[model samples]
Target chain A: MTTKDISRPVCILGLGLIGGSLLRDLHAAGHTVFGYNRSRSGARSAVTEGFDVSAELIPTLERAAEEDALIVLAVPMTAVEELLDDINTHAPTCGFTDVVSVKTAVYDAVKARGMQDRYVGSHPMAGTTESGWGASMTGLFKRAVWVITFDHLMDAEKVSAHWTGIWKDVCQMAAAVGSEVVPARVGPHDAAAARVSHLPHLLAETAAIVGDNGGALSLSLAASSFRDVTRVAGTEPGLVRAMCEGNADALLTALDEALAILQETRDHLATTPPSVEQLADNGYRSRLRYEARTGHGRSQESVSPMLTSSRPVLRMHPGQPNWDKQLIHAETLGARIEVF
Target chain B: MTTKDISRPVCILGLGLIGGSLLRDLHAAGHTVFGYNRSRSGARSAVTEGFDVSAELIPTLERAAEEDALIVLAVPMTAVEELLDDINTHAPTCGFTDVVSVKTAVYDAVKARGMQDRYVGSHPMAGTTESGWGASMTGLFKRAVWVITFDHLMDAEKVSAHWTGIWKDVCQMAAAVGSEVVPARVGPHDAAAARVSHLPHLLAETAAIVGDNGGALSLSLAASSFRDVTRVAGTEPGLVRAMCEGNADALLTALDEALAILQETRDHLATTPPSVEQLADNGYRSRLRYEARTGHGRSQESVSPMLTSSRPVLRMHPGQPNWDKQLIHAETLGARIEVF
Candidate 1:
């Protein structure tokens, strides 16, 4: 697709953290971007931040429909359906997308409204503990994953014509802001997100609950580790609630898996220390692979956003010489190695 | 009490990150400090880093005993007993301390060795993902919590005469390096540490296991939230294992509590999204309290290493106008007012 074919005016419906950040990126990419926010303060802040956002949703929708703009439903899960209903009534022919975390729920909403041809579900796997326009930044999505879901939602023709164009446009826009877009089906997208996103939030929430019992001692004793682990619990409560509720089945499954692992660790702790240590070893290996993939602690030049051809292989046998050193080497090489 | 009384030579056993960091701090505080490491490489690294560390353990122990040095056992749980046995044989009368996570096990060891009068259990609540002497820094323990335990092991006389001197000396020494030393009993310290430290590691490990099921899709979807929540899982596997195993009972309790909260959230999500939102709100409130106590996301000048008197107050009821804003305002004020 040519730049002209992809250069449709972008209308973002919620000027929250994700929306505002995307607006900043798209505007920086030289797109004609308009925004609308439910809250007066949010709209005002978006304007103050130099983004052209309308206070009324209908006017933005009307203008988007007139321009056949790419409409992005950047609101929470609970608000997506209601906004989509408004769009369907007011601008029925406009193709649109959403930036909600849970794909299945939004996909279901699109399917129910028979607006699948126009609607795509996208979730940018990026955010900080804080939310709202004030906390939004242009760099928020840089080098982050922007997952696009469409298998069950779009028909083949719409998928090929509209979505193909939309995908390239979105990816190019994201790449301009340093994001990589990955295509995914709704079910798998929700499932993977549950493991990496929703589950962590739930875990953070549960940890915060655990911290409650210890009184002031917990506060005094909590260091960097505690702060890191429970940081997501400081996220916007509405978002957290939407994440847990909208993706209940997947989140529940992920939670079950996590609890099983923790329970096994607890049992091993009761039996032998080495067994629990082995569990920790497994976790370390997983995190090592993740860090290797994401360039978390490494120098930017040495890290890649994608995996390398050299894969680390772990051999489990009796008397592995210098296994720790081997693990460290594999970690530096960004390979997953398992040694037993 | 006095600078003269506190200025004793210090010997740090196991020249790992914590030990090395402490050595740098104490040595900077103008104390004669020596270190010992089982590994030759570790001792060499310490020496290269300008700390006086010996590979041979016995002579260092003898020297420490002669100077009445505050010996810090900074080894992992597995090596604690063996080193304690060596110390009991060589420096039974010299007052010593440990920097292990679990206090009961080491406290029991001290009691068993009849060295309770000389051995105080201390755990500095600070560390990074990296370990060993190479990762050590002068500010590792600065502004960190250093919990000292004595009520369970030390006799009243030893507590007053020896522990008081040791406590003051250690506190002053830690404070000089910007760490705050707090007195705690074995039970409370272990329980709190289990909640804040051990539980987070288990949670991280569990999340890592969950990510394993999804393969690279999990990696693609994992974001800052995943990294933060699972950051502790990236910790040294042996250390993670030691933490979980050493304090199995306390960790088990914490895990149970977390599971209960999570299970309740799952149930709430099934009934009403608002209920789950309430749970998320509770989590946000808890995290806000923690942040207010610690300088996690605030200006350094505004944040205290210790908790402040201004507590956040949350009053949540139906028809409450802008409760979310109210919560944020309350968090800023740090008052615990709940209107639910």
Candidate 2:
């Protein structure tokens, strides 16, 4: 049931940035990808782009079931429920994964439908300020880190037992699209996303609002630092809200931590003259460490860090012993995995 | 005494990124710029690059005094005091200004030295993450906003009346180096720097630290949003500390405001699930407004906002009535000024 051939036929149930880009990259990698966009215009655009796309959800799901395709939900978080409902009715046996920014909500939703055993989660950390199908491209995921997560809410043994075929297909698709897969658990993935991704979105907006309040003269003097720090604030608001709100606990924890750090700096600055050597030094060293690990200078383009060759990638075997333990350990170490 | 020409011989102290770049740009713009660096290696490198630079501070200042050349302090904030001590002894009559990040610190230092009237502050809002003489370039200030501020702690009438000759020279130099001039008061300028520049640095470093603390797995999944937000955190630690600490009170105020904003969002997220529509929407609109004013799409390259053609430019004349009031008004409006 498990194969290295990612041409297992990908059923993408949305044609926005993530989904559209996935479809294009998979197509370029010589896969059979069926792009399903809810909007007729998006489907038409995909068709014009010589992509295999369907505007009808039922027909796409039916075809996916027939092919035993890996159904990928790439829609907005709010719209995930309805799409899941439709897929459950028509393609329940296909096995599904999602490219949502957060994993906990999606995992909970899947578990609610008693479909946790058939679901995998992906969070591809690549994008620009631009979004939508118009911003989609073949090289969007080139050398990006695609974090593979699992829903362990069900009996861990049962879920790990059922995880092979679909997980292997997902890994193959990710590798085919030029991404390195990093295994992560659902809770930790959400928390980390809240810290590194969702929290940053909130901070970007908050900082932007602060700069805006700095008034005309202050703004006139703003430069690259302000421009860069506030860059993500310009992203589509609805998208920002979806990811931030979906991971509430983790995001709140991140916000509180950031607030505490900033407050400490503020207190230090209350001195007649201030010395923020501690804050600045620690930050500088952290940046250096990040660069050292990622192997990129990070001057302009930001790509995800790849797993070093020394670490092991999990290759699943039928009825493998201690499968759940291996999954947890790999995820905690941020190591890659090959489910096949 | 007042002329439209910026061809006045210039003596630049401390040939680091700011001073070194200024020297190159002024030379390219056909002005005689004498560079002075305390470090012999940097001075030798400048000489090798065919720039006129001095390894001896006293001799450089002596020459500047003889020529009545404008002495520009391009050193770090910590180094400014000693350099001022040397200048007071060697080039007291030269009438100087600086390219420092914080105006109030330099202004206070100048006022304490009884040289406030001779000092016109120039903070050109530009630079990359890189620093030092090697990183210096000619077009660093191209189309950047050079903020012109005064040390008004002295009698306002006296400062305004004594400002024209040295102030005009500073403006001419800024314009020669391809910059627009925006006038501002020292206090407000420092406060604004706290919000727009200093605060962003703190935020960048804090966010970078947060990401690093998110553990290896979290960092593996970080993408462009995290990169851009934390870019300034990679700046030279000394430089970061200097700016953040030099504007201590203002930075504290800014941090408090940002903390308040973030806390509100955190409280809202405490609900069953979060609805961050308010935070995201306000931020999005603020970013749009900023873009509209700056006339830069801000996708990557970030330029300072420019004054529109409709705003009046303040021009100072000898014995001009209400010069201080005019300067304050122009600064508040964020308008440009032409000095002769």
lDDT of 1 by residue, B127-175 (tens): 9888888788888876677776645322443243565456546545565
Runs in model 2 lying further than 4 Å from the true structure: A1-4, A152-154, A158-162, A298-326, A337-340, B1-4, B151-163, B298-325, B338-340
- The CAPRI-style docking tier of model 1 reads acceptable
CAPRI tier for the interface of model 2:
medium
Q: Give the per-residue lDDT digits (tens) of candidate 2, residues B5-94.
A: 864688899888889999998888778789788888998999999998889989999999998899899998889999999999998887
Q: Share of real interface contacts recovered by each model?
A: 0.70, 0.78
Candidate 2 is scored at a TM of 0.92
Model 2, position B82, has a per-residue lDDT of 94
Across A1-340, the per-residue lDDT of candidate 2 in tens digits comes to 2234764688999988999999898877767888788888889999998999989989999999999889999998899998889889999788889999888889889879978777888888787767778778878887777888755523564544346667767777887887778878778898888878888888889888888898887777778898899989999998898888888888888888888888888777887667799889988887766665455565423453553433345665423776667777777776667655
Assess the local accuracy of residue A154 in candidate 1 as a C-alpha lDDT between 0 and 100: 29
For residue B82, give model 1's deviation from the true position in Å. 3.0
Please give, for every candidate in the order listed, the TM-score of chain B alone compared with the true chain B: 0.83, 0.92
Model 1 DockQ reads 0.36
Q: Score the docking of each candidate (DockQ).
A: 0.36, 0.66
